[model samples]
Target: MVLDLLVVNPNSSRSMSDEIARSVAAVDAFRAFAFKTTYMTGPEGAPPQIDGEETSHQSCDACLPLLKDPESEYFYKRYDGILIGCFSDHPLVEALTCLTDAPPVVGLLNSSLSFVSLFPSGPSSVITSNKEWVEILDASVEKKFLTGEARARGLWKGTVSSNLQVLELHSEENFGKIVERIRRENVERLGSKYVILGCAGFSGLQYKLKKIFPEVIFVDPIILGFQTLLSSATFLKCQNV
Candidate 1:
């Protein structure tokens, strides 16, 4: 039987979900596996976008019930691993972890942080949607990825924001602004060698950004999360076999 992975976007925006699917499809096309995917979005009660602590809390309350429901299709056992598609260190990732029966769960932030570490001379930074995420994620990376030695190494720089809402990223006109932010803030101001795309809406724009900044590496955390979760899912399947 083919293994299945579930991706949950903890917001009500279908456009964001579709963007994620498109990016995943691009990655999937190049590398097909005995794996399938199910993309889910936050229910009507959830906000259209997660901007800060309040929206994040609302998302948790709205989506958590569906995830925890034994009768729902999203109940954890159905999939081998679960990817919380939000680009932050979402509350859902930790909430799901509390369940003993839940499969391996990974978030985009967690996966991207880990990936950036592999390139030690990184001077890496995250370019996210809003100012709130800059504060939240900068502290998160420090607590998690930037430890004693890594802290001294300066492998991970910090996070910067474009001050744009997540859904706005879909606009064709806004792409230029995003590139400019990465150029002005992440690359030049911070001298970031590796720039991590820190929002789910920022998916698929990596190619465009790469062309603009040929020297700087633009890391799409969405793709990284999928690869990370799928690897765990595959390993678990093999263990059972």
Candidate 2:
């Protein structure tokens, strides 16, 4: 039997959704399972882009209802796993995991951090798109992941930004800016060996970044989330047999 996955963009940006599909297509990880996948951009009420706390809330408000509504198809269909394509700690994850009997759900932020926490690969960090995210993501990480027994190891260094918008990442010049930030901020200064591409828009950059930072490890959140979800699904499926 083939497993099915739902990849939710959480925001209504058409171009961003297309970019995400391209990134997912570029990866070879899906072959590990006989999997059917559906990609959904946010509906009419969701924000075009989620830049800060307010828009994050707006996107969740628009998406959470449809995911939970008894009349909606998603409420009844049981996917093997779900991937929430937001880099921030969207409340949708908390709602779905705690409030409902949802399948394995992986958020980009949580999956990336969880991976690094389990492995503890040197000093790791997250590269985001805008200035506001530096604070928003940093606080969220501290409030959630960087506490209790987790703090002793100190895997997360900090969250860095390129000061660009979501669509701007498509430009050639903006890509250069990201490379520079990774070099100046993450490499030379911070000495980070593991970096998480913290934006849902930064899907296909791993190959390019590898060419420049060959020794460093770059984690694409979307790919990581997908892998984590599938791994969990495979494990849970085996237990029933």
Candidate 3:
């Protein structure tokens, strides 16, 4: 049987959803599954408070109509799992799951951090779109993953920082320079072993950063989200049998 997985971009950015779909398509595990990517239509651009759980929840809430529309027939009926493509998994993720029948709702932020836990840690940092999101990102980490024995073991190390203007620096001429500067100032200066690109925009720069800092691990949120979706679909299939 073919498992249908819908990757939803909660914000109003179709381009981001397209990029996410492209990345997911590159994954070999998804070949056996039917994958669909959809974008929300409430906001014209990226939501301002995408880093916070509450704001993220609100964004997802605003986008629900699009997901439920009759036009999105396959997404509503055939999908076995839903992946929210936003970087922050708080209120938006919580809110989306509460209102929809979609089960095993996964967020990029949580999946990305969980992936980091598998790494041999020295220090790990999240590179977000702007400085304003740093606090939200840190809070989500502490609230969701940094508890119990995991916190005591110090398996997850390091501080979270933002690159100030990730969206503006998307131009080819500026993208390489900005990413290099972030590596030097944030990752290298602080002695971090891994870096998680917190925004979908940064997903496009993973190759450049890997080439510049070959020793450092760069976790791309889109890739993590896709992997999580693929894994969940596999697990769900086994259960149905």
Candidate 4:
């Protein structure tokens, strides 16, 4: 009853991949489930952060080759599931899912939005790094998780004005100032109870942000993606039994 999971960060930066792994591994759920988590960064040519459709496409292209590597292929064969750690819902999710029949592929964006909906509150907003991502994430939220028949219902009430770049999230010179502004604008002003971290680089931010603003819920998409991948794997295993 062991769970083996692989989280592939669709960026060339190993540091970003390490951050995602560190955040997920620290969770109590990892200990409770007897999980073995492994991580891999994207191909060398992938961008540090996927800002828009073009960069997202580049990430997908770089990811496929990395997944095909011997080390990754080994994990692909043995791991219970794979989670794409980018918040963009990169095309690699579909590509990896098509690789196998048993192991399901989950993306951070899809799982996080789905997780946000579970909260029994209205007017939740997403706090992302770049302004360029505002519309991209909004569309993803509508089309992937909120669409029903011909209509679309977006769960996010608004997005905060954080003009930071995704790659600089962890080490930006004005990190503290930006966080305060996000809390002030998105939480206090906009009446948003929950805020989704809209970039993968924002992994592990909840632990710090929650201490200051305990009343507000900060959703980390990477952790949610890990949980969703593990749950899906367990469910699929049960189905086989």
Mark the regions of model 4 whose C-alpha exceeds 4 Å error after superposition.
1-33, 68-75, 100-102, 147-155
Q: Sorted on lDDT, highest at the top, how do the candidates line up?
A: 1, 2, 4, 3
C-alpha RMSD for every candidate = 12.3, 12.7, 12.0, 12.4
lDDT of 1 by residue, 1-241 (tens): 9969888888999999999888667654334348879988999899999998789888988998998888999877687899998887689988999988889999898898788777877588989998888888888888776656557886677888987999998799898888888888899888899999999899999998888899988888888889999888776665565
Q: How much is 152 displaced in model 2, in angstroms?
A: 3.0
lDDT of 3 by residue, 78-122 (tens): 466677776775554565577546656788888887777766546
My TM-score estimates for the predictions, one after another, are: 0.84, 0.81, 0.72, 0.76
| Top-TM-score candidate index | 1
Sort the predicted structures by TM-score, highest score first: 1, 2, 4, 3
Query: Which 10-residue span in candidate 1 carries the lowest summed lDDT?
Result: 24-33
* Candidate 2 stretches greater than 4 Å from native: 1-33, 147-150
- Model 2 residue 117 CA deviation (Å) reads 2.1
What TM-score number comes out for model 2?
0.81
Q: Rate the local accuracy (lDDT) of all candidates.
A: 0.85, 0.83, 0.68, 0.76
Error of 3 at 108 (Å): 0.7
Q: How many residue pairs clash in all the candidates, one count each?
A: 0, 0, 4, 0
Error of 4 at 24 (Å): 26
- Candidate 1, RMSD to the unseen true structure: 12.3
